[model samples]
Target: MTGFVYSESYLNHITGTGHPESPDRLKAIADHVRNSEYWNSLKSIKPNVISTNIIQLIHSGSYINSVSEACENGFPFLDFGDTAICRESYSVAKLAVGGVVQAVDEIFNGNLDNAFCAVRPPGHHAEAESAMGFCLFNNVAIAAKYAQKKYNIEKVLILDWDVHHGNGTQHIFDSDPTVFYLSLHQYPFYPGTGSKNETGTGDGLGATKNFPLSAGSGDKEYMDIFENILPEIVIQYSPSLIILSAGFDAHYRDPIANMNVSEESFSRMTKIVVKLSREVCEGKLISVLEGGYDLNALVSSVEHHLKALQGN
Candidate 1:
């Protein structure tokens, strides 16, 4: 198996000074992943930039142009207070999307059983046509749709266990039942979406599941929910491929949000998801980093995450 990592060389230009979602978030995780024993189990590569058409699969041309435009002329603050763009934002965002795509390539090519793309600015917050929540593009959504278009997989399973709900991802696929979107997040959290009642709509109805926990939720709450909800959903759906929205902001030490998840908590949650992938997707899984603010938590949590990915 391979755990693909992108250098912070690109991320350096994606954020503003004093940003929580800054490039250092990725650097910390990379250092942890590479220095660990699990690094020996992984083949490493820098993620490439995505082609324009590849991005157009889920994002509209206008939205794509907006990002490109932002890249050319310095940058613009994304929307409200969610995200920012800079001269190199488009390039790095494409690299993030390409990281997931390349992970899919490695799994499909049989070079690896699975991968974890340690990339940012985190996705799951970027909608189809909008760049928000520090995300310039929806990397997971982009990779999922790319898998379908390129492989005719028809069904993709996205497990987003970020402390905050994956509102953008849920929004893009809410009406498209071809994908099963499962998310567990803190209730009344940022972006204020992903309520239990926000199950898919129309043909997509019942194809989505959201479990919103209270603040201070920890491993016990997470493990309990996964054992009960995750298994039933995966068995019923039987997805051809699985993608993980791995976010570490849930760690107890994170400054941006309140959640009782610890480093060991990340390890436990990752192990649960890995087991499910083994049963349903033939171990075909690609994990992409979404959000994790605390440097130490990010580093330690990723080390834990990669160990589980290595079957340790």
Candidate 2:
């Protein structure tokens, strides 16, 4: 199997107690990666620092500055509801963003065939100006813009499989034709945005595809959509690269959300995505870990996710 990239600072370790988004989630991932034989495929690497100027490619100064201010003034909630920040949160979030950007660069430069970012403060729910659902920075979006600006790649595909819709990601790219945002998640959930009719608008019309399955939808329904819809739309778009907002909270054992996506589903799903990347983009794929509350489920699912990613 081809070697991959990961990092230790991905283990930021400072959210709050039993806060659905806790450090333990990443700790479990780190521990498993260390114990598993598959760990050999992953080498620890540092992010190539992209400046605030580079970050501005996706986020506004106000949003970036405000989060920094909140970290300075003291820990305050960043989300409208659940997300919060402590003193170290800002620094750790930087590492998280760095991890994604580095993963993007490594894949684009052929240092690794593909990479999975094991960082936290997950980014899909983070928008251009607001942080929501535990996300402080839009990691995947920043990578998308970096790819477009630096590589001159015209089309990038973002696939959100987080059990909840990536309203923030969609809103950020809804008007841009150069990026395609596709989400397959539970309908009528938190942030409540994805729907069958809520496809992309303006120049991005038909680019944003949503498959909002019912609350109890399990591997069967999820797999059905992936086999048919995901490949068809993505192949049509013919993305230069595929970025995954990979969230494991959809697993049946997760405490926060209740979709029945098991560990096997994660591996199988990754297999399909890799298949698409191979077919069209020569396998330029990068995945960033997102929302997953249950520690056991998160660990198990992420392990499966990486195994499939490594073609192990």
Candidate 3:
């Protein structure tokens, strides 16, 4: 059955008012999920606090220390960057990573058909040694590494449909052929990393696939790309586990990004992923929340996404 990982501590990673990545994002989704009919059927799991040793799988030691010290000293922001943090952010970020890790473990252990992590301080923009873009650690990236290290998974597929490209994730596994990173995002946008030509490097060449769409691209365009490319890539890669950098910011109502993806589109896209997992990996899949600014849209899109996850 489809399961979910959550923690009230996630709300402690506050970014202040007017900040797009606020605590309410997760709160809205959590409340909606609990009130839904599927609540009784969905397994609710609490994530264990992860070790710094597990974090070292993807982040450098100095960077980890710096983040810890910053949180301890109560630095306003990790850098003179867009990412913001408070006293509890360091621990909360670690918990966010833990949530994804727990999802990976459950899926691999046959306790769940799939899982979703409603986490905060999104991680796609975080690099191996730095925290930026409202992120501390690259949660999904770490989960991918965890799957490889702990589970002996041979090949993993990461599908990111966030409005913005997952630069950190792409770069992390860019030179490793074992992980295939595929992203569909708005081109010529923030952080500006994803491009058609920037496939991969060295042994990882062609393992990374990017489909950069325009700002106004909507459901049809997104689905067209998915139908054309996603299935073919899944068949070619034959991933043992599929991880999603699932961000709802692409919704037309989202404040931070420009895209026209609707609630229905998210379900359709999710159905595609679900079917792919069934074909390629016995339905082993996990989605880690990335970005979504609008509360109502985030909540509704997540409901649709989970409904698809539950095979509803």
Candidate 4:
């Protein structure tokens, strides 16, 4: 069965009014899944609050303390302005990381084939020392580190399909060969990091890959890379685990981004990843939520993603 990691407490990390990354996002997904036909089939998993030491796998101690202080003091935002947070946001962010880590544990323990984490305060933009793009902690990055340390996973493949480039994830793993970071995002966009020439560095040379597509690129443009380019990289890397920074903001209806990707395209992409995981990693894949602004579009896209993960 496919695992579904979530927690109602995730909604506690409120971003205040007019914020794109709000609690309603996960609430919509939770409500949709509960009412869907696949509700009974999905192995529901509740996430526990993990220790801060686990978070240190990706973020520094000082940075973690800074986040805690900011939240404790009720700071309005973490970064310059995008990452709004309240008093409970720090705890909620830890729960988000815990959710992803639990999914990894379930997969490694032979309890599930694959899983999707419906977490809040989307994490792709978080760096090792700072929070960016509405992320307080890097969920997928911490999970990757946890898997490698606890389960002795030899290699990990992080595929980020967010509309904005995951500059933090890329920079975190840029010098590490054991983890390969691949990002397909809109170019010249927010943060302005992912570019064709910005491959890996040091020991991780050629391990990082970026496919920057211009705005208005739709399913055809994305599928070309997913079908034609992604498989080869997966086979060659032969990682022990596959993690997706599953962001739905690339959808046509999303208010934040300017991509025309449809829900059907998200399903097809998930199917391809599922196939690749089966071929390379025994179908051990974990998808962590990142960015998806529009409530209806996010819900539909997540439904399609979950169905594909279920092999429906």
Q: What are the lDDT figures for the candidates, one per model?
A: 0.84, 0.83, 0.92, 0.94
Per-residue accuracy of model 2 over 1-312 as CA lDDT, tens digit each = 333345555555466676888877777788888888877667666665556776677788988888888888876677654677887777777777777788777777887878888787788988888888888888889889888887888899999999889988999999899899999888888878998898888888888888888888899998998897788888999999999999998999888777898899899999999999999898989888888888888888888888888876
Candidate 4 residues 199-296, lDDT tens each? Answer: 89999998899999999999999999999999999999999999999999999999989999999999999999999999999999999999999999
For each candidate, give its TM-score against the true structure.
Answer: 0.96, 0.96, 0.99, 0.99
Model 1, position 77: C-alpha lDDT score: 73
Task: Report the candidate with higher lDDT, 2 versus 4.
Answer: 4
Candidate 1 lDDT over residue span 1-312, tens digit each = 756667666555557778888887777677777786667778896787668899898899999998788679875676765677778777788888888898888887778888888887788988988888888888999899999988889899999988889988999999889998999888988879988899999999987899988888887898788777678888789998999999988888989888888888687777877888889888889999988888988888888888878787
| Pairs with steric clashes in candidate 2 | none
- Model 2, global lDDT: 0.83
| Candidate 4 TM-score to native | 0.99
- Candidate 1 lDDT (Cα, 0 to 1): 0.84
lDDT of 3 at 192: 95
Weakest 10 consecutive residues, lDDT, candidate 2?
Answer: 1-10
Worst 10 residues of 3 by lDDT: 74-83
User: What RMSD does model 3 have?
Assistant: 0.7
